[model samples]
Target: MKRKLIYLFFLTGSFIFLSAQVGINTTNPQGVFNIDGAKDNPTTGVPSAAQQANDVAVTVGGNMGIGTTVPTNKLHVNGTDPLRLQGVGTGNSTTDPLLVIDANGVVKNIGTLGALSIPSPAVFRLETAQNNFLQAQGAGGAQVVPMSMIKNSIPGLTYNAGTSTITFPAGTYQITFVYEAQHNATGCTISSYFVDFPLNATTSRIHSTGAHSEGALSNHGGTITYATTLPANRNWTISLGRGQSGNCSGAGMNLSATSTQILVFRIGD
Candidate 1:
């Protein structure tokens, strides 16, 4: 009977131990928490050492390296190599860069440029003027001297009497004319040559003159000189007429037939 009682006691202790173990299993999820190698319940919710190391190795998004870094937008690069884009070929060498557009885009490597257009035209015109002399006197025959006469006397120039033009096609020119008075034994006064711009009738006048003794000879002359800028094309013209002086007489001394007048024209830039 005693042995039977002892056996019952042992069985009761076994049941008690089993019930306590079941309660601990149900209540304690981690089985046992540790701090400095001492057994205790975890006061703060913190991953164990093993769990923390695993988290660092396989981060929530991925590895924290260049290629494995998390992307903020659709177009992104791996953390392993920042320059490399996702799904692009893998290599250290740079590939043809893809143009990335941001909220405010950027333009690069554009060259300098200049504008172009057509030019405008300029305006131009021609200018003309005249210079001459005229001499006349009361109660006597008159004479008119044209600028052309002097210009023709120039050596390389060809004078056109009818057209009152002078042409210097080849050589240079230095021409001059002057008028001097002379007294005649028959009481006649010589007329001095003069120049006049026929275009202006009223104001046409003669240049300064000098008088000389008669019975011998009295002559007057003027000068006109110029160099041909263009030897190939050169022409000029002038006109001549008799002068009126108080003692002048056309009967005794007549103006020479070769003594014609002329006009000069020059063109240059």
Candidate 2:
């Protein structure tokens, strides 16, 4: 049986039922079932803006839309408020303002940051959206730190573990290396200790010297520092060794997790 209930007028709280396309309060139905809402005063102080034309309207059906007939998301807002998200120095300085959503689904502008804190080393690492000036990482042992540890790192530098070399592209750079070193006198006669930055070869050296004496209980410790220009395609290795006058000259020296470590960082271009 073919049936239709069509009303060419607008009304509220009206209902019509049939196994056909029912147009309640209007001659046109947009969906399988459509309701032509009544002409009423809009929040914009305009009349019939809901149906007669596009104005401030709260529409709801399959998808809820604000000022739009075609809703692309669950809640689609078609027009701009031009006032929301307006402020200065938000979510930053101690006195800056912030925009936050409340439990009542109202957006409130507050004069403080959120209460949440980033508790992990890997989270919220950057100080700002554009620049990273300092980087820090802590390790328990004397493990070799590779470039992968930097959450933000610029290019043109390389580290080779096999040769203990750091290669930099032809440019002037200020390199800082800090280390703690100590050697037991068990291997050979103690003379002097040294930490060396050998560029290209051991003969070309930058040295930090320390003192030592003979005894199993005697261990000498100090730091090594160096800075220079690296020609294009040049590499350098940092090393720790006993002084040439010591009996341990041909003997090898090793660094333990507790006894020794090297901290290296680039200060500038």
lDDT of 2 by residue, 173-269 (tens): 3443443333343654444444445343233344444556755634444555555445556676544443444444432333333324444433332
Model 2 residue 194 lDDT score: 44
lDDT of 1 by residue, 1-269 (tens): 00112122366446322211111111222212111222232333443543222121222333232121122333333322235347866431111223443553322332211011111111111111112122333332233333333322222335444454445533322232323222343444444434443221121434333454455444433333232333534543243334444344433332333332232332221
Please report the candidate that would top lDDT against the real structure.
2
Q: Score residue 265 of candidate 2 by CA lDDT.
A: 39
The TM-scores of all predictions, comma-separated, are 0.26, 0.36
The positional error of residue 119 in candidate 1, measured at the CA in angstroms, is 34
* Alpha-carbon local distance difference test for all models: 0.31, 0.40
Most accurate candidate by TM-score: 2
- Report the error of model 2 at residue 49, Å: 32
Question: What's the lDDT of the predicted structure labeled candidate 2?
Answer: 0.40
Q: What C-alpha lDDT, on a 0 to 100 scale, does residue 146 get in candidate 1?
A: 30
